[model samples]
Target chain A: MNIFVFVKRVPDTESKIRIDHKANKIIKDGLNFVLSPYDEYAVEEALRLREAHGGKVTVFSVGADEVNIILKKCLAMGADEAVLLKDDTPETYDGLRTAKIIAKVLKDKFMDYDLLLFGRLSIGADNGQVQTMVAQLLDLPQINVVTKLEIEGNQGTAYREIEGASEKVAFSLPAVLSAQKGLNEPRYETLKGIMMAKRKEIPVLPLEDLGMSAEELAPLMEVVNLESPPPRKAGTVFEGEAEAAAKKLAQFLHEEAKVI
Target chain B: MVLVFIEVREGKVKKSSLEALSEGKRRADDLGAELHAVLIGHELDELAPECFSFGATKVHVLESTLLSQYSPSGFSRALKELVEELKPMVIFFAASSMGKDLAPRLAAWLNVGLATDCTETGIKDGRLTVVRPIFAGNVFATMVFKASPQIATLRPNVFPLVDPVDAKGEAAKKNVEITEDQVKDAVQEIMREEGSELDVTEAEILISGGRGLKGPENFNLLRELASILPRSAVGASRSAVDSGWIDHQNQVGQTGKTVSPNLYMAFGISGAIQHVAGMSSSKVIVAVNKDPDAPILKLADFGVVGDLFKVIPPLKEELKKIFAD
Candidate 1:
């Protein structure tokens, strides 16, 4: 029962953004990067919790070298392995130096892992607070965003959703959840799972060749500029009966859009 | 300075934290500094005179009982010790669900610079300049913060909550020591959840629907015109909540819930930029949509092309005959 997950590569959230004027930022030429639509619901909820609790699912990222083509597309949506923490100008929308470089590249693989997953925010910084800030710098036990998950033996639970209800929360078995885009519906990779993810295996490292440091994960907070916005002004067509245009749109929401 | 956290929950105050306390008193009076706010949980002295009627010149208070249910690592360690003793410049919070889980760990323990959900803000020579809408609003990003304690998270009814241009609650606060043993995220109880009472941005009327309201029991005809208006609330879109016909918290655009209510009424909804990023700062967006070129009718301000079962039961019988005359 290992898990890990954590993905990232961003910038293709339909990239039409520009703003580089000498590195003020976000002009990453042409765009098209992927693998972060909220980490495909945390790599499909860690491949459906290792296909209903059996074991194995790994995955990690820091990116660049085109994040090995989105970690082989999360090894074709099943993830039994992959690491990729390369880093070369991997300024990754700086969410706390990308969660202190995924907590210093998983601080000694967090005691061989028991569970750690993210993706409840990150369309390149939608900020779902980095899997509870890497479970608060590895102090652990975080259940955030969830949307559902179970497990029994070591007691897990999850659920989350918050703000208009849905909590559940139970935590125990080496936690850290996050995952949230409706929590499931991810899949998409078939063709016999893309011919068995073209023979699995993803590895690749370089957090100072695994020893780590880039100022032990730099970035206090950046992105001085990234731009793209300014185009919203043409609207005013209220014609005909839908109850007489809801009465001149209820009198333009009450006298020239005063909003009732 | 600007600290504004204020999220009260079942005890009042949270019309998006009074638009994050009037955008943290307009970014602390646009950097002339000082505006505080903060209010964590518990009885909160009746939402502290409505955070001094929304100009919170100052008002720290951390009200405990482990801040009665809710612990994003104990509200980001009581806002990272009041942002290390109020080193604010900007720190709005209220992207909801507890400022999207305590504004990125209080901007990663005050290292600074953050821009979440934002949806427009400006300051200029003193920085702040926010505006955020990505992927779900189809793109619009404009950020900045070279530091000076800049942190944002707004996006709840996109600003508009003034009231006390500073009548009393003057500038000068203190009480903020927090305990429950300086929580590290342990609420061992409360899984309680009773939600559902139309609060899409404090609903001032909203009755959304989409995918032509063909399933999930036609969302009770958009909840019968949101139980007959008077601060309505029903919403849908994201193709009727991914076609389950509703319940993705009654979805709405841009990854849902960005409502600007005051009359949104979109039925058989066709709009999609994730539902116009949750309502295009709504306020009169009426779109009925029989497909008069549906892109939520270019952010409607009024465009009933036609047919939500003949336009919502005669506009819910003309709003129950004008609130019964």
Candidate 2:
């Protein structure tokens, strides 16, 4: 078995997000970048699968040069190899364009892989479209938001959470699966693993080397403007004993809000 | 034609689909095009009338046992055939789990652009433009599609479901073709959580907790409150779910569930943007936290600065009294 995992670098969840309205983009200065939290689950699941079934885990990411930091983290946590699909252009926001580039690379280079893994959704764009698009491009079976998975021989079973139900689905080998929460607990990188990762070299693949031109990778959608959400005004705040506040709240619900 | 996919579960239409229908109808009127709906499921003949009442000019029904449950390959192939024949100007889907899974695959199959979880949609300069949240709902991105039959998935509860009005034209039903072999992924079973309790997305009132609750045992406080309120459900922030204090199904956030309950009450939640993206569309929000500066309080319609342990018990007691009377 061979596993390929896609990782993304995003601002830490705790970091404050600021929008540059004048430039129609997010302010990247002074923000801490880390591996997307959900992708950590994917990386960990890949390592576990390697342990269960003899295989090598290759982690892939597409971004600027700074994305190597996240690739190193994945390597330290047990990924056997890291590849960076470099995209330094301004048109990287289009999910389909990104998916097309990845599908091209996968087809040209790693077509023999048995499985592809991805986070259920990237926290930064929240698009959740690229992995499925890639699966379609590859014409392979795919499942999203999988909570539980089991593989035996050439077949695999996955459980995905729906609105109020869970669907148990089975597919053959050479498939795409997105990791949801509860898939597994991501382990922290150990000292020995970190030291070992320092000796590994990550290969960067540029679009030019992949024989893709800028016209082919151009985005279909343009960002009209980027703005912060309208500030939510502070509503009336009550300060008093718990009982009095509760009474006032109940009154407000029944009278003003009329929700109760 | 502007086509909207009417999602059905257990032989009934979903509220999110109704919302998408309403939005699609508005967009169709703006474009002076007919609004059509497609229902793909088993035993869906009875569900077409509701689609007509909700403003579908024509309802397409593709009934097959293979589509009784969602399979990416089956539904997308069925819809792809319909889309290729109709050549619709736009397509709409609810950004639910099933819709999120199906829309992109269809878009990729058709080689078109797709926007997911769109909060707003309209026609600009003779092209469709959609607005969606990015960076965990902290920033909004407005996007335009470059191809015809542009596809978009709408966030549930973001659009209004207007009253069912009489249709101008009778809804014509058309049968679509699908084969069992088209569905590559076989469904072994669909296990629903054993209960009659409403899920968070379907609940009208939601009481959610965060790490501030101290521990998993404290979730009982929220369950107690939920029991007292009508059609209420308990929810948790991602931190609580990550801490193993609650089930992921009960988690409400960017990665979890996006809910727009009638009233959302947060207990000890600091209101991270990821969590806010899920529940910000609720009709009204009330926050209770010890810290006066919690981000949730800023978005809440009402705030009480106090310890949740002290406030929740009394609050539940007061609500129980009112209901008893």
Candidate 3:
């Protein structure tokens, strides 16, 4: 029951996001990067599966050198191994292109895996396409936004949330599942685990080594511009009796807001 | 022609799909392209008239028993066959849970690019360009496809649904071949919450609570207010969800659902950047909190510096009176 979890490093959700209009990229100065919150659930699930099934949990991430930090964090949280599929290209945040590279790597190597895991979406680009694309490329069964998962023998059952209901899906081994919130509470790294993780070196595989040309790996989607949403102006604040404030707010909504 | 994929649940078309079809109609008119709709399932031709009223000039029904329930492989394969045959210029899908799951698989099958959760779409230089919120609505990225049959998923409730008008249209039924082997994943059951309340993403107005709600039992107050308003739903902040005070489906924030409703009323919520990222696109925002300096007060169109427990009763009464008029 070998498990493969794909992880990503993204700017902390609390951090202020600023765009570099000249470069058409995000400004990286003085921003604290952390493992994507959703991916934490994936890594935790993988570790638990490995513990119960008596196998290894290997984590994969495709990004530049900065991504290694997240890979190391996964190792600190009890992952057996970490691999970085390095991408130094100027084109950033293409889900299809990234999926192609990963699919190629998985096809060429690591053919004996029984499970593939991914965070539902990365916080930065928020595409939520790569895992499904990878699953399609590899021709594997997939279930996204899974909340509860159970594995027995060579089969797996997962419960995924929809708008007003939850679907119970069953699939065979070698399937892909994307983690959503409430999957599980991820554990923090222990002192011993951190010390052991610091001594491990993650192997890096460049995109060029995957035998795909720049044109083949090129992004099919173009980013025209990146900018902040229009600023929202702060309107009047009523400070006084609760009843008066409530009445005034209702008046504003009726005449000015008119939402009701 | 532009193709819009329609999703049906329990024989009824989803509201988000209608919204996507309406948007597709607008884009199709702008580009002078025919608007067509596709539904992949059994016994769906009966729903074609609804699609026509919304703006689809033609509805393509890909009927297959294997596709009666949604399997990522089965539905994507069926849609893939249709796309290859029609070769439409573009494809549109509502960014619902089904759309989020199926569109990418189809895009991958065609080896084409897809933009997800787009807020705006139009023809630019004779190709489709879209605007999508990235970094959780903190920033907007304008995107364009580099290949033919450009695909995108429009965010639910963000796009306006047009009034249905009678239009001359036809439904073309095709029998798609999908074998049992192709659908390795099976849906055993669908567990719906009692009464099937509206999802927050599709709600017109939201009554959201935060830590100030105190406990899980306090959520009933928000639910009471939501019930009083038409097309309203309850939402929760990250703190409230993290504390096990509510379900994740009701959570609205960066890690939760991004919602753009007509009116958003936040109670006892001190806006964090992540939470604000989800609701900033809301049309009108009002906040009630005892803390005058809560960040939500700054972003809200109207702020009340008072106790929410005290304010909500009067607020509900005032709203009831206004609606009575």
Candidate 4:
């Protein structure tokens, strides 16, 4: 049960995002970056799978040196090894190119694995395409937004949450799966694990090592512009008795909003 | 020509796919091209009329016994073959669960650029440009595809479904051959919810509850409120869903589902930034909470400062009367 989990560092969901209008990107200065919430679930699922099957879990991420923060965190969460594919391009919003790089590495270097995992989507780009693209590039079976999973031998069954139902899917081993919420409650890093992770050195693979250049992995789309959504106007607040306010709200919805 | 992928579940075309067709119609009109819709499944020719009514000039049915149930490899390969033969100018998909999973694989197969969850798609300078919400609705990014046959997914409920017209269109049938060896993943069964519940992304009105609702049992109040409103679905904040008060499918937040309903009613919700990013695009918002300074109050078009439990009963009663009239 060799499990590989793909992770990304994204702005904390709680952080206030400021745009750099001049560059058509978000201003990252002073913003807190954390492991994407969905990726945390993926890492935890990898750890659990390793614990159950008695094998190793390795975490992989593609970014600049700053991505080490998230890789270290995953190591502290009980992953056996961590690797970083260096891409110094300040902001790479192309999920397809990223997927291509990861798939190439998996094909050329680490071809033997029981499972490959990813978050449903990266929070910053919110494209949610990389996992499926990687699966296609590698010609492997894949499932996304998985909530429940069971494995035995080389056969795996995953439950994907659809609109109003859960689709049960069965696939062979060496498949790709993306973790959705409610998969499991991720374990907090123990003090001893944290101490060990602080000293462990993670191997970094430069893009050159993979025989790929930035130009070859150029994005498929260009960001023309970015703007903040218009702020909602302040509305009248009804502070009277509960019954009266409720009635007033109904009246407002019927008359002013005209939604009813 | 523009190509739109229509998703069918239980032999019925999904409303979100219709929304995608509506969007494709607009793009076709803008580009002065024909709108072509494809349904890749068995016994789907019956659903072609809905596509024509929504402005499809032609409907293509690609069916195979192996393609009856969605196999990521099978469906994507079928669509890839169709795209190769027809060579449409653009491809559109609704950002539904199936679409989200299938579109990227097709894009990779075709080696084309794709924009996901787009709210605005149009022809600018004779090329496809799309605007999609990124960072959970905090930022909107305008993008231009750099390759031929631009591919994109439109967010549901954000795009309006055009009025159905009594127009006729041609239908083409093609039998796809998919070997069992190609379908590496297979769907075993589907466990549906007890009732036919609307997905939050497709609901016109969303009645959402939060931690202030107290517990899971209290969500019945929200269910009752939703019952009073037509085309309404019950939603929950991430906190409520994380607290195990509701299913994650009903969650509306950055980490959950992003919704742009006509009206969003947030009750007992504190409106964390992540939660706000999901529903801020809604046309109108109404918040009911005891704390006057809750962040959701500021973002809502109507705010009621009172105990939700005390307010909900009267609110439901008042809405019932209003609808009764």
Where does candidate 4 clash, by residue pair? none
- Cα deviation of B217, candidate 2, in Å: 2.8
Over A1-260, each residue of candidate 1 has an lDDT whose tens digit, in order, gives 88888887777543555566566555567877778776788888888878888799888887667787777778877787787877786454557666776776678655678888887776645656677667767656677777778878777877777656666656677778877678888988877766777777666777676665566565655555555444446667655666776665555555686655
Task: Chain A TM-score per model, please list them.
Answer: 0.32, 0.96, 0.97, 0.97
Mind giving the per-residue lDDT tens digits that candidate 3 earns over A9-108? 8889998988899989999898899998989999999999888889999999988998988998899999999999998775465789988988999999
Which of the two candidates, 2 or 4, achieves a greater lDDT against the reference? Answer: 4
DockQ: which candidate is best?
3
lDDT of 4 by residue, B1-325 (tens): 9999999988899999999999999989999999999999888899998999999989999988888898788899999999999999899999999999999999988877889999998898889999999999999999998887899999988888999999999999999988998987767788897753788888899999999999999999988988889999999999999899998899998999999999999999999999999999999999999888899999989999989999999998999999999
Model 2 steric clash total: 0
* Residue range A1-260, candidate 4, lDDT tens digits: 89999999999988889999998889999899999999999999999888888999999999999999999999999999999999887765667888898998998888889999999988979999999999999989999999999999999999998887889999998899999998999999999889989999999998878987666588888999999987788888889898899989999999999999
Candidate 2: segments with Cα more than 4 A from true spot: A213-215, B168-176, B317-325
Per-residue lDDT over A1-260 for candidate 2, one digit per residue giving the tens place of the 0 to 100 score: 89999988988766678887788877889889889888998999899999999989999999889999999999999999999999887534567888888899999987878789999888878888888989888888888888888999889999987777888999988888998888898999999889888889999998778898776687766788777767666688887788888988888888889999
Interface RMSD of each: 11.5, 1.9, 1.2, 1.2
Q: Model 3: C-alpha RMSD to truth? A: 1.1
DockQ of each: 0.13, 0.67, 0.83, 0.82
lDDT of 3: 0.91
In terms of lDDT, the poorest run of 10 residues in model 4 chain B is B193-202
Q: Is candidate 1 or candidate 3 better by DockQ?
A: 3
lDDT of each: 0.70, 0.86, 0.91, 0.91
Give per-residue lDDT, candidate 3, residue B183: 91
**Which docking category, incorrect, acceptable, medium or high, applies to candidate 4?**
high
- Per-residue CA lDDT of model 1 for B1-325, tens digit only, reads 7778888766777788888888778767877877778777555765666787777766776756765677776777777877777677777887877687777766766556467777778888876777776555544566676565777787776678886653667433344457654554454444444435645666777777788878889788777766766667777777677767667766765455567676787877786554665576665677777778887777776777776677676666665665676
